[model samples]
Target: MADIVVRRVDLGYFVRPASETGTEHARVEPTLGYLIEHPIGLVLVDTGMGRHPEVDAHYRPRRIPLTAALRTAGAKLDDIEYVVNCHLHFDHCGGNPELAGRPVFTQRSELSLARTTEHTIPELIDHPGARYEELDGEAEILPGVVIVPTPGHTAGHQSVVVTRRDGTIVVAGQSHDNASLFTGDVLSQRAGVGHHPVWIDRLLAFDPRQVVFAHDNAVWTPGTSQVSAS
Candidate 1:
């Protein structure tokens, strides 16, 4: 079997506030994910920014070009076989139309909250692909890929564990949007204390070769893997 490989595709879209980085835009291009060589074929972690810039520009979504992001990775929407949402935030699921009829795996609780969170932006939840198979509970999506429940950022928020031929890596969607958070920054779970200490413990217990986060500009390469970034 060709070992599973992971890539962090910077689908340059939104950024943090200027106060955070001091640059004119002071933003970051959030990354989408690619989990390769899994038994169920290929899986795209999140669909980057969707097509709603005009609708929510006045509010607060600083988006980049998603089409260009995918192009950099040498991928088209059709290349993704299955889609897994860390959570259904607008920026994350925007690219789901790449496979309108395909199944997107999500948590029922997260979907419910996404639908009725009241305070969340409505545009994020109004996707045409919400008919996803709501995760009943923790289980495997592929022989080597398992979805681990890591609540706190949002109910039913989960991460994927890709067990490759060499070592395992955990795609912690929002668990650690950046390395600083996982390394102990109080602001780690910025989406509202949605992170639990237990989840990190469990994830590390598995001893991942690397930790990939959804919105960060960096990656943590474990001392163990030659193939992963340190």
Candidate 2:
């Protein structure tokens, strides 16, 4: 397999309501998506924020429409061959409708919740041309790209693992919200001191060269000396 390129798609930002964040003051977070340029085809991870009056009033999202975002990433909507939504949250799968007919890979459990519960925007999940390829668990959607369950933010949340000649990259969409949180989890796992997700071990096994997140711009790299949160 040829070396794959993972490009960050800036979906824009949003302000989290204080009540929802459990913080005294609302916090601002970036909504990001990833585009994996593979030899076989392009795979998009997470769309942008979905529109809803109540959600808008709560999140106060400043969205960069999916088309524009993809353009900035050096691609177009029509160029995307497959879609992998880390989870079906409104902010994550917002642009799913646009890529209808393309196989949108999602966890079966996540799809069930998104359909039966008030999980995400209804239309985003079951649009006119929506085509979902629900997976029961971990599956390799591409030659060197694997989707592993990383539930926490959501029950069926997952992350993408891309292995290149140099090293591995994990697109941990909202897996830990930010790179710092993910780093802390890694540190905790190392020292065996605090609670961390079981899937953290799975990700660690990959020894990722860099880990990116959906809500934070920072990237997590190995080594405490090389750790970068800014």
Candidate 3:
């Protein structure tokens, strides 16, 4: 048996749709890429991005500081075999075209919604060379790595749970960008923030030793303290 290692890649920021005007406002979003090294093969959590004509022409995905970050993690576009995006938003799945023709796993619902909804990257789900999966339940993406459905950010959003030897680590993706969301916010709850109670409860129930976000450098580990990328 071989061990799989999950590496978080800081892919930098992009503007998000503003909360009020529905206008695109730059928010220094924390883009992330996860690398899973397994004996079976190299599985990449998210492709991050280089550039895209469709996105550039339409949504205007901002500059990426990820080339250095991806190299630092020893990952090249060609090195990736499998891709699992927590969800398919323009910023998160912008890199999907780079890994075209590869096996990309995403929530089944995300794939379907990408068709009519503006919330996703169209190329991601309908790429000519890509193999997409709209998974409904848990599966060991790699040996010790499992993908969990923590839908909230969108109906199909999910988090990746890695059962490591030291302890379990949950890659909470967009379910909650920071530790603050977990504590419960009345305003956000009323406005329908992130994952619902069930999804949030499920991640907490696992009691993962560490929780990491796809965007920023924030980290939450159980029985410990809070940490962020400063």
Please name the candidate that would achieve the greatest lDDT relative to the true structure: 2
Best by TM-score: 2
Question: What ranking emerges by TM-score with the best candidate at the front?
Answer: 2, 3, 1
Ranking by lDDT: 2, 3, 1
lDDT of each: 0.67, 0.92, 0.69
**What residue runs in model 1 are displaced by over 4 Å at the alpha carbon?**
18-29, 51-67, 119-126, 185-196, 223-230
RMSD of 3: 4.4
Q: Where's the lowest-lDDT run of ten residues in candidate 2? A: 221-230
| Predicted candidate 2 versus true structure: per-residue lDDT over 1-230, tens digit per residue | 67999999999999988887887989999999999999999999999999999889888999999999999999999999999999998999999989989999989999998998876889888999999899988899999999999998889899999999899999999898778788888988999998999999999899899999999989899978145653
Q: What's the C-alpha lDDT at position 85 in model 2?
A: 92
Residue range with the least summed lDDT across 10 consecutive positions in model 3: 182-191
For each candidate in turn, the TM-score is 0.77, 0.97, 0.80
The positional error of residue 113 in candidate 1, measured at the CA in angstroms, is 0.6
- Local lDDT at 4 for model 1: 67
TM-score of 3: 0.80
Per-residue lDDT for 67-104 in model 1, tens only?
Answer: 56655666666667788888877667767765676678
